[model samples]
Target: MNYYKDNVSTNVVTSNCNYVVTVKDWPAFLNEYNNFSNTTLAAYNAAYLQLGGGGNVAPGVSFLLKFGAFLNLYKADPSSDEYMPLKLNQNNA
Candidate 1:
């Protein structure tokens, strides 16, 4: 599986079924994420146009900005109340 940011693969991991995989290149991943977060609308719009602009790209961009902002906040202070742990259901597989 590949984790992507700004349509670029940042990390790649292979898994079969019974083992755990760790992302060893955290710095590279963070760099890619920061790049995506700092992308300007003009750049995004240009890319969108190049991809055959058919739908409004504003909403997608807005979502990325919002999510990136939240991530930044969490990175700044993981102990902050704004950070919440997701509760996963134990019964679900």
Candidate 2:
């Protein structure tokens, strides 16, 4: 089966071994995911350059900065899953 929303298309597949699964606008999802990833990477690269492109900065700080960039990108897209809080198992691992 196929579905479309906001001009994006999705295909659904099912079988005896599989449940009712939905892709939900795959092409648009990929495009948006790639855009967010690329933008975050670019921001991280710029920060690395500013920090002399070496081990001159703390790794935690660098990670936080890159994460902040990702948050900014997510904020720009209200429909993105990036805004969802991560769920972990009881083991927390």
TM-score of each: 0.22, 0.23
Q: Candidate 1, overall lDDT?
A: 0.37
Model 2 scores a TM of 0.23
What C-alpha lDDT, on a 0 to 100 scale, does residue 41 get in candidate 1? Answer: 74
* Per-model C-alpha RMSD: 14.9, 13.6
Top lDDT prediction, candidate number:
2
Q: Which 10 residues in a row give candidate 2 its minimum summed lDDT?
A: 68-77
lDDT string for model 1 (1-93, tens) is 255432332221223212112233556557766866799978866655544333444332333333332322111133232332222233310
Error of 2 at 40 (Å): 12
Give the Å shift of residue 3 in candidate 1.
18
What lDDT tens digits, residue by residue, belong to model 2 across residues 1-93? 343543342222223111112233456556656866778787756756565435565433443333333321111123332332222234331
